[model samples]
Target: MNHELSLDLVQSSVLAGVLLILGEFARRRVGFLQRFSIPGPVIGGFLFALLLLVLRQADVATVEFDTTLQEPAMIAFFTTVGLTGSLSLVRKGGRLLIVYLLACWTLAVVQNLVGIGLAEVLGVNPLLGIMAGAVSLEGGHGAAAAFGPTAEAMGAEGATAVAVASATFGLVAGSVLGGPLAGWLMKRGKVRVPTLVTASTGSTTTVVDQGSDTGSDSGSDTGRGPETENAEESGSAGYRKLLSTGVLVGVIMVLGTLLGTWFSDTTGFVLPGYVGAMVVAVVFRNLNDRFGWVRLDSGTVDLISGLTLGFFLTMAMMSLKIWELYALALPLVVILAVQVLVLVVFVAFVVFRLLGGNYDAATMAAGMMGHGLGGTPNAMANMDAFNSRFGVRSERAFLVVPLAGAVLIDLVGLPWIVWCMNWVG
Candidate 1:
């Protein structure tokens, strides 16, 4: 079984390249994925997983599950997440953003509780279930990778295997839950799609005109309607000032990590380098917003996110052992089933009411369902599905959901999990 090439590295690199090419191709040529309820990443990942299995069975390719690649990708993804963590977005979203973030945080907590309970009942280590269901499933691959090492340190066997299994199941469940929940909410509320019209005059009108057909209308007649857009534009500026700000923040984070490492060495207190990076980013974003020094570019944030996530998914998929998952099949199925039920009921009743029982509510719920179960892509897919049938309010969903999935909730989830671990421990 010895091979010259590093099997995991080679396989993941190859898979990422293939996914990028196929993703672009499918996005351009086969619009069915965009038209239909399926998510592009989900489709890509599923096809890749199936292909890997087929190749393995045929003895055409061999893959060794390498856990090492997971950390760098995870750190890169989280750093991207942090770079977008401007308080401006939160301020712009206002009460609605707060509600959504709180809802997601609550869901993460509930997910962990459900996992722990299930594991205790099934006589497996509760930490294993917690890692699989909450950390991996709700938090996606980044959290899975972050927690995998922690799980091992805490005495959970096959922590990486559990993380992989949970991430796979999360992808499937997240994609499935979002569209149906949004559809159901729309049906229950009798929400009607608004007539979209664009004025041909004025800069504001021109911007509106361009985005109107795509249903990105936000009711504000301003050139830039929301905080997210502003932050994105601010962040995207490639000027010396913006680049300097980003670099300064990056340096601060690096310095913080070094300080933490030294402190840990001296006082037996451990700090993750990514955590230091995130803290620095958060602080800088807040300071920038307060002082009007520089803005965060949405395009840059999105670009970093896409590249980091692509690499992260590649690492995750290449490290999967299909055979190992077979052993945990029964519990995995049960956990997924419970998660699906929980999401459906939560979105239908609780989330809708909190969101004011409107079309936007339905769309937002769909996005949350996608994120809570899968990740940001799934959330976007759900919104896309809702938009295709009944014109989407793109700004509302796009601004809110991405902020929730990409930054706020992700940062918040880590500390909450640590708190839970302490309480349980």
Candidate 2:
């Protein structure tokens, strides 16, 4: 009458790969999904989850997976993120960049506060609120996958499910919010696009290039453009770089996991293994930047990140227990609703004004809604839509938003979330 199927680590990993490919295939075929920038893994994995739900309701069978590799995959991805934190590049972004970075940091804090406050009012674990907050909103699926287990380890049931669900909501909400907001601002005829004027040597004036998305030196930093590619044979060179980057990530992950374990054991802290790996990566990146100690290529690192993140997210999504979210459904909806409302208001009033209230500011506001609720890719999509309609580009927005959203914002945001998780637990 009842049956169960359990998979070993290798089998589970192989299944995850299949699901990831399935998702990608679906995304390529589905027009609506492509429009909203919904991730492929979510589509494929969620469909599987739905099938399992139906099977369980029919009393058919249950399936289980061994996810021993999930944590390492997560750690490797975060380590790639760590490698991207270049303070020298931050300085190159100048004052406006600093302001945008600060705004991102503030948004992360506020997201957590709003989530925690709402959760307490609704009578759920505040840790779940943290998951719905920065863990998913700004951190995206990767963070949800990384921290969900930690929240569960601290006794918050269904935290991962809540986080993943919240992130899915955000991805859609962000995609929709950005275009309308920017369109309204543009139609109002109040904000005007202006050229940037830079003065060097107190006499020489240079006009910043308003064409390229990544700007000059930033191409390498954000892993954009072929210029960042290492010199070697075209096809084989890429494979070599990817392999080298994987090796580097592995070394850092091992060191970070050991460090996290030691720190947790010695000090009774709740430091996650990925956090340790990220920290080591940040240090190594900064030192390498100053000393040129290693042959680090951002393009290769980005590739590694993409591969690991896809696999981790697919694994996380497939493992989700939809039934666990049943009791928390109403509270989850309320929290997400408030989050969307707060984000729109904050971008309209605070972020727009703080960014100087020009056409560039409006474009940046769209990006804020994108990554503020979703991830950097969502932000880029929002900006792309806005630019395509307006017939202009906000090079400053493109430069600052992605640079900060993708890498620098996490420098402060991750530590803050870690602290909040500990305090609440």
Instruction: Return the TM-score for each candidate structure.
Output: 0.74, 0.89
Candidate 1 residue lDDT tens string, 240-341: 554654465456557556754775588654456656566666776678778977666666656655765666665555444555566667876687678778
TM-score of structure candidate 1: 0.74
Top candidate on TM-score is 2
Worst 10 residues of 2 by lDDT: 224-233
Give the residue spans of candidate 2 off by over 4 A. 187-189, 193-239
Residue pairs that clash (backbone atoms under 3 angstroms), model 1: 232-297, 232-298, 234-295, 234-296, 235-295, 235-296, 235-297, 236-297
> How many backbone clashes does every candidate have?
8, 0
For candidate 2, write residues 1-425 as lDDT tens digits: 65898999999999899999999999989998887778888887777887877778788988899999888889999999999998887899987799889999998999999999999999999999999999999988789878998999999999999999999999999999998997776666487655556677657778977667566555566666544354434767778887887898999999989989999899887889899999999999999888987899878998888889899989999988888999999999999999999999888888888888888888988999999999888999899889877678889989999999999999999989998998899
| Candidate 1 Cα errors over 4 Å, as ranges | 1-70, 189-253, 259-271, 292-298, 392-395, 421-425
Task: List pairs with backbone clashes in candidate 2.
Answer: none
Worst 10 residues of 1 by lDDT: 34-43
Candidate 1 lDDT score relative to the true structure = 0.68
